[model samples]
Target: MPTEVLHRLSTLSLTSVKQLGRLPRLSSSLPALPAPRPTLAASEVPTLFREPHILSGYRPAGQPWSSYLLSTFQWHNESMNVWTHLLAAPLLLLRCWSLLEGAGGPWRLLGDVAALPLVLYVVSALTYLACSVAAHLLQSRSELTHYSVFFLDYVGVAVYQYGCALGHYFYGSEPRWRDDILGGLMGAVYLPSAALLAWMSCACCCFAKAHYRRPYPPRRKVVQLIPTGLAYVLDISPVAHRLLVAGDWQRDDDGALGFHAAQVVFFMMAAMFFSYPFPECCLPGHCDIIGHAHQLFHFFLALCTVCQLEALFRDFLARRAAILDVHGGELVVGAGVSFFVLVLCCLATAVWMRRTVQKRLKDQQA
Candidate 1:
């Protein structure tokens, strides 16, 4: 009692001492407890802009710009859609560089015929892919952002389609004014149609907000197909005319015609997937993060671009004799000017779209 009582009295009775004694236990217990996992704020997690069955599986709705960006690293419906094109852009760009470098040097003749058209072809493909990446990634940012980016995406498609038409017109035929006149006539017919389709798509997106919701309306589906149908008409008419004039489908010595055929097939497949929304429609939610129709559409579109490039290369080789006879300097200048004009037009349209969208957003907010 004497020793125990003395020890107890010697021990501090202060609140600080009691708190100090508990500190080690609290520290030890913390290590045993699981760490707090990072979580998104409810508002940070996006909601679906479309119906569940339409996309299937889980889809993010609206989110802020930062979260929309960060979402790229996470699994979501648009993940594959974004990545398929994002990854393709660099690969296509590298292919463009390799093709351009190879066309130069001792093969200057090849460069003369192929260089500008090839460059334009790859650049146009890259533009579409890059725009697709932006549109898919930022779709959840806001309604304004979604519509704006998608408008740009449609414009990108129009630009690429026009580039394809121009490439065929420039390099597909012999370098003659008759061909040039023909090309100009074709472009005059198709380019304005493409532009109108693009405008129509933007208008549809802006005005028909309700069209995107639910059961995929028949009218909306038809309206959406109009631009694609126009693209098909523009892309196919010249090729069809060429084949008709050539009058020998079986004798494609360079396989350029065959490649064009394959390109059309791939383009059709892409369009089919885009319009149908296949296996996703059948299974519903099973392929949301991975094998959806939209992703398939992206894949097919990339393949179509590849086929187009191959066709361009083959056509260049086939026309080498004619191309060699022409004044290389003049041809180069003409092609350069054309490419510059195309780029300027695309950029101008983009700026106009951005300004229009911003104005509309401001008006809405006000």
Candidate 2:
């Protein structure tokens, strides 16, 4: 194969950091400098800092952290990506707070362990958005920061998936589905498997990030996407089962079923954007600063979250009694502990991968 073709093919995937065949020899002495201008065209920035089909508005790598944060005020490629979640983060927080206040203020949540799932959902939502903001906003500071920031972002994604599963299992599931589906595997495998899948998703995504270099190959998407898709399927299975089973799909106490139904639709729509570089790939530079597919992904995802929060809150109000009556101890403590365990495991994995990234950087310097 030609050298360029061989290098491109090598980037399809890698088994480990050491397998980064002919690693891209990134600059090792980029100063912590300020932005030279508002933004650079794609040709000016490092390939690693550029986006697919995005031919302009690239932030220069190695700028001080504040430049990136301040860039939120400037129109750049990532401006919408940052604000989409940054703006939605506050709205989601207020909505959850309002629900808690109406229920008798924040202390009310503390009074009942049964509220842990809801609490987890809120935390997971906010955490993921915050992680995304940090990643997109500051990732340009350096290649190492890029990997580290996105490793954290990947953790947030997995954490959110697990939170969604907890909410679905606790609030959205029908009793019959719980007892009947897969011979009640949810009773035994749901939480543990969700946790495991969450960890796996995080690890696999980090691997893909490390395995592939920019400009990333087409197959790189599939490598990272498979694990994420698996995690989402597992995370949403409880609700999927409930929605599929006719016996309980008709039951609409508190009208949560409608909200749950809407969430499913929105999520599926969002998946399209998540999996493809659409609209943007079709018209590259035109969508650089706005109307980007990733921005669309965030928008649709936020819609999904809106529907999910409403449905889960409604269930908490109307279905909590029945759910509690059946499963007296929801293992609220164990569930909380499980989430933290996932957090620790993901952090450890991120840290380990980061060490590998640090080594790669050193090798490039060599």
Candidate 3:
């Protein structure tokens, strides 16, 4: 009787374990996602959804949000635009995950305050990539959604430009250049004005987008790119100075120079396509579904960002000892303060821009 009783209890224990294992499977069997929506031509969607020379393969506006999410897997005018940054976001995260947990291991990172800027840079890069992904994916839902998401996208760009300024200024810069004048933005407060430029550029872009019609004219293009270009020039100052004026290119001790040069080249190439539409402008509807300039633009921009991160990471490591000596514990305070200020400013700017977008959208509807 004792043996039988023990045997029954053992069987019940085994059964309970098996049931617990099965529970996970049951829990994981979630409802299936929506299937991809049927795509439309440029003519099918309203003019607001259309892009010049992109004659086909637009997702119909007002799809359930799920359909837009599912469209990530399907082909459309925005597929590469969605994927280039979507895939890159995870890749960037994967590359930076170890660093976030502490670059010199968790313990060493506690003392290495200089790693702060790199951490901020990583977070900013991820923010921009995620925003770009959201913008490309959901921008087709409605006029309001289109404006709203893209406004957020511009905010992301502003954040990222400030981040790039941080990484380049601290890690990649020549110290002599750091002392130069720009509204006494010396030390960690470097480029506060540049941040304003970026913020104002977002406002400029929003205004252009609101007022301009599809197939934006040269005037609209100028309004969009002029301030943005100026911001780019200022934000890129450190790297540009290092590569051009400081002659950092002549030194190849860490392979950072190569990566830096590659980033510049890739970014300029991508920016050209972003501005002009290039061969797509020449080919038009023939290139709509498969090979479009915007698609190539997305690809090259991803590559540029990857190269930028690579170079900046290399520089951070190579200059760590010097950074620690020159900056001391100020590394934590300086980087933290600057990033905090930038976030506050960006959030404020985005909120103001959102209100403007809402007003414009309401006016359009009315």
Give the Cα error of residue 65 in candidate 2, in Å. Answer: 1.5
Q: What TM-scores do the predictions have?
A: 0.69, 0.88, 0.83
Tell me the TM-score of model 3: 0.83
What is each predicted model's overall lDDT from 0 to 1? Answer: 0.60, 0.78, 0.74
lDDT of 2 by residue, 195-284 (tens): 998898999899999889887887888877887888888778777776776545445646666667777887888889878888989997
Residue pairs of candidate 2 with colliding backbone atoms: none
How many residue pairs collide in each prediction? 4, 0, 0
For candidate 3, write residues 52-136 as lDDT tens digits.
8888988888768987887676666786687668777876676565544555554665555787778777888888899999999
Best-matching candidate per lDDT: 2
Q: Please give the ranking of all candidate structures by lDDT, highest first, separated by commas.
A: 2, 3, 1
Show where candidate 1 strays beyond 4 Å. Answer: 1-48, 51-67, 101-114, 173-216, 243-245, 248-251, 320-366
- TM-score-wise, the better of 1 and 3 is 3
Q: Which pairs of residues collide in candidate 3?
A: none
Locate the minimum summed-lDDT window of 10 residues in model 3.
1-10
